[model samples]
Target: MTLRHSLLLATASLIVSATVAMAQEPEVDCDNAQTQMDMNICAGRDYKTADNELNAVYKKALEAAKETDEGFKDMGEQYVGAVDALKRAQRSWIGYRDGQCELAGFEARGGSMEPLLVSSCLADLTRKRTAELKAFYEQEN
Candidate 1:
């Protein structure tokens, strides 16, 4: 709940969001694919790559946060609250990603839905959770 920690969280989120968005861009050939399964698989691979990159960013953020004075000292219940909120946000995002992807593929034929579903879900969830995290930080500040 220090300004530094809040800023770090915000920066990390932005970095991860940007990285994932960039990594998940679909290939041109995917659009012209005849099979739904192919499209879905292709999309899934792209999303998986982005997800891995996002995990790396999260790990770096955790390390950066832990190096902070507040993170080291573990001061105040607000710090704990912030960590809890972040964990909850991550879990919720995973759920949203899986559910959205499943729904997108339900009526489709192939992997084509992967990129669309993941990108859409990630964008929506990231925006919503960023707002929540910002609010939490504001209240803590």
Candidate 2:
């Protein structure tokens, strides 16, 4: 290849390598996150963490419901419906929380701040859901 073509190929390779390195770097390291985009990505990950905790708590609650189903009729529910009620309530709560957070995100829709807004909302709601499920846990105890 010609010298000029060789230089251009090397330059392109360096740029691609740098881009990949930046993409792989942790956003939370060394005060490295200073941009709105980076903050949004971090916020999204935070929401995922909170959602994972909520999921674990939710599974426990559902399992508890299932285990207690036989006594639900004894408690005057007329049948084994504890698990069914818990499932329905959880489904409705998820829908309500997502719709509420989506409305909250509309304030920054189509903008760099949108993901941060949505993710903060999600984390907040998921934390609240976790608390609510924990209260149910208290009842089960």
Candidate 3:
């Protein structure tokens, strides 16, 4: 009934609501995919998406840094390096994912559906990577 008590209750309610909203958000699980191929594919997708988001955020930050301080303009070079690294990692991951998935399909040292398995694996990897990047960017934003 008191003003102080009512304000305290309102603040607690807001905190609880915010916590629930965050907890209800979806999470990605590439490791637990139904098939090995699916897992790889999801991981690949997740990486690619993350790469894209990282690049976008870096670009925005570079621009903002430039505007805020002329001396900071050179920091864009750092962003460029980060972008390059992410891209390189993504490419290497693609190769590793496919190779691993194809190797998994070996029943008698080689299988007919190896290609399909590789594709699915790549997709699963990508999905998982994308989810990770989404989380990173979401935090930054």
Say what the RMSD of model 3 is.
Answer: 15.4
lDDT of 1 by residue, 1-141 (tens): 999999999999999999998877555576565665555555555555656656655555444444443563657655444444466667877787678656754554355565566554555554555555445444443
| lDDT (0 to 1) per candidate | 0.59, 0.87, 0.58
Number of backbone collisions per candidate: 12, 0, 29
lDDT of 2 at 63: 80
Q: Any residue pairs clashing in model 2, and if so which?
A: none
TM-score of 3: 0.39
Model 2, residue 15: C-alpha shift (Å): 20
lDDT of 2 by residue, 44-136 (tens): 888999999999999989888877886666777677887889989989998998999999999989988988998999999999999998888
Best by TM-score: 2
| TM-score winner between candidates 1 and 3 | 1
Q: Is candidate 2 or candidate 3 better by TM-score?
A: 2
Off by over 4 Å in 2: 1-26, 30-32, 73-77
Per-prediction TM-score: 0.45, 0.74, 0.39
By lDDT, is 1 or 2 better?
Answer: 2
Best by lDDT: 2
- Angstrom error of the Cα, residue 31, model 3: value is 23
